[model samples]
Target: MQYNQRTDFRSREYNGRLNMGVDMRQPQPQAGSVHNDGINRQPMPPRAPKKKMGKWSRTLFATLFVVGFSVFLAFFVLESATDLFGLNKEDKQLEIVIPEGINTFQLTGILKQNGIIKQPVTFQLYAWYRSLSMPNKKYRAGTYVVNTNYSYDEIIYKLKSGSTKDETVNITFYEGMTVKEIANLLEKNNVCDADDFLEVIDKGEFNYEFMQMLTKNELRFRRLEGYIFPNTHTFYIGENPTSVAKKFLTDFDKKITDELLERMKNINMTLDETLTLASIIQKECSSVEEMKKVSSVFHNRLASGSSLPKLQSDVTINYVEDNIKPFLKVNNQKMYDAYNTYVCEGLPAGPISNPGIEAIKAALYPENTNYMYFLTDKNGKYYYAQTFAQHQKNLAAAAKAGAGVHGTTTQQ
Candidate 1:
């Protein structure tokens, strides 16, 4: 029965295979085919190679770039150099004022501001270079009439050469003249404008020792009334105001010798006070001898304290009337009080006139005497008196001698 069971199972398997007709074996591979883990797959396409540039094309491109850059650089340098030379500028006339003591940098700034030059740094460098070649050449301070089209060399030459023969004038300011009169004379001779000269007198910055000793007083008519030395000076036709002022101040600085300074110290008087007294003596006296005598009278009165305080000078009133009143907007009593010795005690607010050397010397070294008053006649003769009664007698005698009797009338 076991042999028959084994033979029956083999017979059943053969019968199932004949019924379905199925194949259980592996298939054969095809030619010209690749397999991935016994499976067929499609192949990928090939990639193309990259293109490269030629040598001649790259060389041409580089040459064009370099040429373009060179052209741009050339144009930039040419424009800057032209500006540095002050060429290619418009043909325009300009008037510029060069301040005193200005350095080269500040001078260039002024030129640039006035449209005379385009580049300040380049102009300064050019100036430095020119200075090395021409050591004597320098820029001057004054009013200049310059053309905008001028080259840097031409401008420098014009400034350094100074004024021409026709451009200079010799003007004389007489002694004892007021600042206003001096201003008028300067304007008439075309040295400078009167207002400009007056403005400089008030606000100009002078570096002299005497100028440094001055105090700022707003009530004074002209701050430098007596300081401007009277002299015959040659000046440019239209000089700078500050330069003109410096000319006068420089002369004053020289005139005040060391001996005079020591004398001022010995007298216990300031430069301002000495100048003020000198101005009064200058106007009141007719001759140098008379100046000393009149100075003694004033000095005597000043030493008497409150007994004879007021100077009572008639010239101060004349100054107020002629110079100050005409220029005032309204009647100012305080202004009159400031300069009129009749109203205020001690010296007038400032010097009434510019004193000459003689008058200044007279004020410093007055004739030692007991004189307290002085009077002048029409003949320019002076008479001195010690007491009020004697002064009245001299005044009467002066009046009897002629109709015109002038001078101080002070009381003890």
Candidate 2:
């Protein structure tokens, strides 16, 4: 064989120097002598066993291997190594529709289950850190589209807002429901803070998040009474407190404006007065027809001028609702608060309760009638009386017509 050519094995020479594909210097063996460079010239001490690749090269390659493994390990920690790159590649735009008012704990669970996030803890930490750093805190509610190809940190940043473009969940509060009741419902499934939520409603405490979006003229309901409109609405999950409140108010006003207030002018009434009357109508009218008829009677009584009291209504007694069962007797005097028509004149300080569409319309366009007094039939239909004596007679007839209503004292 030829003495030398280039190969991976020969990197250095016996001259204590290096070569890059060309030999600089090397020892030559004596002719016919196997142990020339050694004790017996045994091939020059076996060329130092080719340096055995040393610990340094092994260490360098070991380090590179470890680093490559660590990168793979990081992916596994993020999401069980499910291949986020493939996930992102699969669907460039993914729609993750989370409902409104979902708590962080619940939201984290959902993200993991939905495969939107690789690690729940990672997401939680990421969101918390980002939220702290953010100038404006709290996530908004709405439909959103997310891409899954990102790493844990990358995904967290992308979804910091936690809103979606889709509308699935709805956050709603009716005007008539008490704060305790509303908060209880909201916290029932861990949607909102129970104690903190009540603070939001009853205390009128500002939710830092919601305050940012308040319209210039929109009034925040101090008492929260008659503020939350009773209706179903769409809300995105993970919305902050302020956004939740604003959405309720927005929806409430929308309903009232479209149906109640606009038609009020047609009926020669103001918004407050119309709502007040509607509350009464809602309380008094047992049947839908009765609601219309009773509304008419109240209007007629107001027009008569004979009764200067402007048709006193007692629904406010039921406004701050007490069960007042027929058998469960309590002092009649104590129950006669502002809501008692017998005690207070005109509409109670404000609307007794938030009225619905039918009630609102009844206030606007009551059925045409000349009757003054109204009583309930066995089926809760009204029996109107143009005269007081007729009203008394109808009352008796109504009481006799039925075996006395099991529960009484104001509820429609």
Candidate 3:
């Protein structure tokens, strides 16, 4: 204690450098820290602690996952139902039948079962979509043809309409053909039986008022004889006779319009009378111009007030004869039937054959002429006569021209 050491660095250095210029009272820097000129750097920030999952949190996560998966599945199902991807393309020919009074679901099931449709529920949705575009859309019951190559829209279109893959036939009925001839032609074409057609034409009661006015007794021979209005007609291959006859009658009603009826009334002629005279004029003349002239001749004779009121049309006489020949003999010309213009006065009972529009117009409005008689030669050359003497001379000329007696009979 009496000999204490000196605290000064100079004294320590003299004592064999024991202190070595160090300070023992200063604080030290921590590990993993750098000191640059007595300045210390801070460490990195601490990480956050992980939270524990509770029962409610786990339920919420699971619920969200299930809802997302359900939405994805529902979208896939809807796309398939609408055929949005256009996947059902098989290109196979299929025959499908839908019975009467079936709902959309039943029809869809049937289509799917028949392999016509791959998805029933999807087809139902497709049908619903199609119905929106149509004004009145309803699936018809019938045998249908479905081609797999066709789109769903096309198949729905065919099903909505009653269109089917059935055999079709076109029957062209030319003008001037009689009802009997038409019946025979129908039978020959396998459209219907001749007897069935005749029966339907005779007994069928149409809704048209013009046809209604003409009773069974008023219409001679057949009720629908000259009213068929010959033209090209199309029908199903296995159509019924009554249906075919109805089509003909319907066409006739449309062709003979109300304006024509008014015109006939203005000319002091009934529908039956006009059709009858038109039929006679049609058979008498070979051409349209000749028909007008022949109609004039008949008009003159009717208005002539002569002792012989009979038309004396040779065709009318031949019409009543069985087995019509090219040349009618004098002996064969005598017929006791009311249709025989030679024996009967005025027009015949009814139309002899179906007349075209030209003949009908000719009968309705005859050409203005004073001529009372006309004759057709073998060459189809018509000779008109104003008086009896001129008619006799024309007859002599026609006989010299090698015309038959049928030509001579038409002269009177």
Candidate 4:
């Protein structure tokens, strides 16, 4: 039952005398055998050579190990020696351009290729260590010019932080652009979205807090389209896109000067009417001269005691949809709804578009004029008169000019 058992014979000499496997009746050796000691003379199965180590071997190995370990520790502890002995350019700058969608192991290889780090395995080890501290180290992909002067620690720090500041570009939007126009401008500039931006502008069902953001003067009418002042603004780091929009609206309120408001009040035009007129002025005039002329035409007409006191204009119909919808192009017969100047008696419901300061100023200080009727000549010059009969004469003159220019009589 035992796994290890000793031989039954006293020694090998006795076992050898019996030759092959012996039966129980085999004879034993004599008492005075040739053996001097009770031992086997067939040479004790060569005792395993003593395992004592050689003298020089022990000393040599200990010396080599001490020197090797000193070297390893020296490299590990001395920070500067990492670069001194490692396979990397001592003075080269790492120009790394990380394309999109590569995993971290591939990223380590890229660092190795650029000589940013000598060993990919060591780089990975450090990256893993960083991952332990911050599992989510998302550095945006970019082209970087990293100097070798920075230590491994600092280099990794810069790559992970991705602190690239885009050189700022200045973009300016005029005060009177619709939200759609603003969205288009932003889309063109590659900052934020056009559609989502439009959503923000359209989200005019403001809650109590944002409503409270308005000064009382701004609250005289609905919405903040024309209220945002237009000027050249340069955006750089720390420019929150959303906050910029809010700031624009705030600046708009500032431009609505007290003098302009007083002028509107004195003339008995409601703030709504003044802003509406301003909006029309903004659309009609490309220059200060034209703006003042257009403003005078409206102001004088409004002040007139005639039954046709309405400043009926085609722009009013376009303004009816609030300019959020596209501009309308309808025939006069179809436009004969109350929105039609030929049918309706007064101004449209709201401002057609946001009005800039120049437009507002023009509306406030209209040029004094007696022209009750005006028409665009063939060349877009204004031809003015005081009576319907005279307006007809101007129209006929325009027709004659068109005929003279084109050799055809106009039929209207």
Which candidate tops lDDT? Answer: 1
Candidate 3 matches the true fold with a TM-score of 0.56
- Scored by lDDT, model 1 comes in at 0.81
Cα lDDT over the full model 2: 0.56
Name the lDDT value of residue 344 in candidate 4: 48
The digit string of per-residue lDDT tens for model 3 on 1-412 reads 3345444655666555434755545566676566757656676678888989999999999999999999988986875654532354666778888788777788878877876666667777877875665547577888877666544655665666465664568989877788888988987876665766787787765677777656345325666767888889997544556568878888888888888888998988888888888888888786887888889888776776765587888777666663233223444332335577777777777777888888888988898987777887677788988787788888888887794734523434
The candidates, ranked best first by lDDT, are 1, 3, 4, 2
Question: Which tens-of-lDDT digit does each residue in 1-412 have in candidate 2?
Answer: 3445543235334333432444655656675565544554434344454557889999999999999999988866645434432243345557665566655667678667766665666567656764554545344455566655544433443344454432346556553554455656655533444555444554444443323423222211224444556777564443334445666667556666555555776766766677667767776665676678888877886676646344545445554444222312454444344446545555554455556777777888888888776666667545677777776767777777776432222211
Q: What TM-score would each prediction reach against the true structure? A: 0.63, 0.47, 0.56, 0.48
Candidate 2 worst ten-residue window by lDDT: 213-222
Candidate number of the best TM-score: 1
Which pairs clash inside model 1? none
Count of clashes, each model? 0, 17, 0, 0
lDDT (tens digit, per residue) of candidate 4 on 138-163: 55577766655444544554555463
Ranking by TM-score: 1, 3, 4, 2
Instruction: Write down the lDDT of every candidate, Cα atoms only.
Output: 0.81, 0.56, 0.72, 0.59
